[model samples]
Target: MRAFHVTFEPFSGGCGCGRRGAAVRGADGRTDALRLRAAATAHVACQVTKPNGSTHTRMGIKKLIIFLLVLSLCLEGGSAKEKGTKKGKKKGKQVYCPSQLSSEDLARVPANSTSNILNRLLISYDPRIRPNFKGIPVEDRVNIFINSFGSIQETTMDYRVNIFLRQRWNDPRLKLPQDFKSDSLTVDPKMFKCLWKPDLFFANEKSANFHDVTQENILLFIFRNGDVLISMRLSITLSCPLDLTLFPMDTQRCKMQLESFGYTTDDLQFMWQTGDPVQMDAIALPQFDIRQEDIDYGNCTKYYEGTGYYTCVEVIFTLRRQVGFYMMGVYAPTLLIVVLSWLSFWINPDASAARVPLV
Candidate 1:
């Protein structure tokens, strides 16, 4: 399809009466090379580059090839744009953070309500208040320093104990977004600003380990169900009334009572986690042997003081002095002395050394 000027008198060998003009046509017999090249270059910008960095077009044949490539490109571009729009719309939907709470669950919210608070409160005793001790430590601080003089065996007999108190309740206000497991928030006492806490107090508290601030704390557990559990660790000292009639051979049942400090029975109430009023901790005292004797909960009336009645949970600690130390220190020595005293019969009670021991 190269461009060539048509020559006149081209049919000399033929029997032509007059000179005929030869018309140059492309292989397609439709368009000339120059016109085809112009159309291809105008419609398709792609060029066939040679090693010499020059562009070459293959006359009429290249025009159809470039046109088909350009048409495919245009169709693909439209399809890609349509697909992108649909994907963007699909991704635009919002995901929820907090799962919503039901209305029935919301009505059961315990904050600021007149309902009684229930908790699992269990007690344990740490017996190692001092070196080589065998009895229950009195005050964790005080019993370590107590001294024994004469037959009194003057050691404190109170319980130095840790109380594990746990309360689990739902406050719908503590809910978090369903999408968030709550990196966004936390639950603390302040979060339950409107919730009423049972005014629990130790009736016979002689000393407290944490006196300045409350030994209480609250933690938010889950946002979905609005579940929260409040846990408190309390170190308490109670002066147990001692009856030393049995001396070292006795088991004592001392009591620790928990009652609402100022709340009347109408204003506030407390209940056990289970149907039973008392729950025992599995851990036992290290030195002294203690078992739960009795647990009773009832209204302690203060009719004389006009203070009405207060709800109380009372626990009785049944314990025996771990007698190994007592056996060695008191019983063994007394037994040896009694056995040696028979030597006085061998000698004369009238002798001076014998008289001194006898006296």
Candidate 2:
């Protein structure tokens, strides 16, 4: 009896019969042509037994069909699973554009306490209108603290001073939350533009500058009762007329007057704080001394011909000149020269050089 061997290779064409492929090799020394009925995708080898020269080609083809069917199902299931995973990821990353959202949608978004309160207060607020409008006048209280004082120049007839200018007024429009615990809330300086502020200007200003080092030197505090307070540092040069006829003994008066630029007395009025409206920090000068008693303030409201009377407040500073510098540099030197000319009379008719020089 002779034994026959069988080996299967991957099909090169589409599934089923009628596809051309390499003929299967057998171990019988005979090159008989055989048409395989197996699917084109099957890739396995099997042995066929020929008992008493009988063939088992039908049994071999059946096994190959079952093996290829199982492999094709598994490949299709894995591809579907991957497609499902990609779809889930795309749905999770979905985001809505802000421009497509409506006002009701924006209201649904959550915000912290401070941001919500600010949005409510500023939503309908107009900075152009005064607090009371045509009703009662808005009383703006002013306070000034002198940080440092510069020289009282006789040549320019002006003086420079650095000060912190503080102003307070009530709005009654910034409603606070009921659960708010603090008496006041200090806000960022950038918020200054969103609120109505007094149109205060210096009436006696020759030149002025608002400090801006290390961010703007502006502070704002909003009180629970809608009382707004703003303070800023300023370097100001004010005109001061001097009576130099008194020379080093002159006492000059310098004034800083605050007045409204737009709103008149009917809409806004200026007032000084009750106690300690003006403060000093031991300000020293080279040629003058600023006494605390000489610092005074009063209402300087006056009327104009066409324009009505506007609100005004003035702070007066009296500077007394020191004579120590002049006595040593001017009067003392003059006295020595006159005394030396008298010595010319005592020393000589004989010393011509000394006498002529002294004369």
Candidate 3:
């Protein structure tokens, strides 16, 4: 069977004078077309009563549907763009900030400033390797400050000392900006773990400890000329043999020594600071008075059985024993006892019991 689709236009006048209705023709062409057209035209007339506002209402409905469709398309486009941005962020690497500064300090730095100089120097840096890999020796200047001196024991032949050790060296790889204004820069102590350091140890120390009461007692300073400094506090028990042949009036000599544990003289060398290498606070001990101290910076290349020659440095301390303690506690009491015994002889020929007790 064949079927026809028809469309009708609204009537112009009350009698439906001027209008066009669509129709399809079949084997019974004229009859079928006339029936479909009449049916559609009658249906349109019943739906709209007044001809004056009918056209305007139909146009308004069409505009509303178009506006809703456009709004929905725009919303979908925005959602797709947001998803693409999030995926790009997940695929890219995050930037690294300097660990030496806290977040609050980093906020104070200007975006374009050279305050974060470490970022440029440490891009490809390796902390496990030494600075100079071209077979050149790195010269380090060493200094010390004796905060206290005590625990001098004669029986155990050892003494305890607390000190601050500072070492300075230069690495050409750490370049500074041309417009840098500061003479030196101070960084966080934790940065010490991220940089290369010389392997140094005390030669004559029996035991040692690094200070860490509230936090790690360490310091780092960088100069404009590529020099780096590291300072730390340490307590050490060192061998200090004493001579007691002179007993109460004896003077004792002690020394502290430092040497490289891994690097030999060919790769590293240590020298004392030129003018004033050693400094100390006012120190006092119970049994001895400090006479003098000596700092030796001469070359100390010594050969080991397995390893090559290593570098070393030494500091010597001279202490004189205080004799007044012995006099008051030992000599004075003995003299009084002998004089009292002599008096007992003069008074006790008849008092045998009292003389025996005194003797």
- By TM-score, the best candidate is 2
Candidate 1: list runs displaced more than 4 Å: 1-157, 168-186, 189-194, 211-228, 275-287, 292-304, 347-359
Task: Supply candidate 1's per-residue lDDT for 143.
Answer: 7
lDDT of 1 by residue, 114-175 (tens): 22011000011121122113432111100011111111123675666655555554444444
Higher-ranked by lDDT: 1 or 3: 3
lDDT of each: 0.47, 0.77, 0.73
Using all chains and alpha carbons, the TM-scores for the candidates as numbered come to 0.44, 0.69, 0.65
Candidate 2 ranges beyond 4 A from true positions: 1-112, 353-359
Best by lDDT: 2
Clashes of each: 7, 0, 0
> Per-residue lDDT of 44-93 in model 3, one digit per residue for the tens?
44334445554436765456456545645555576677779998898654
lDDT of 2 by residue, 190-276 (tens): 778778999999998999999988778999998888899999999999998888898878888888899998888999999999898
Clashing pairs in 1: 97-177, 97-178, 97-179, 98-177, 98-178, 98-179, 99-178
Cα error, residue 197 of model 3, in Å, equals: 0.7
Candidate 2, residue 300: how far the Cα is off, in Å: 0.9
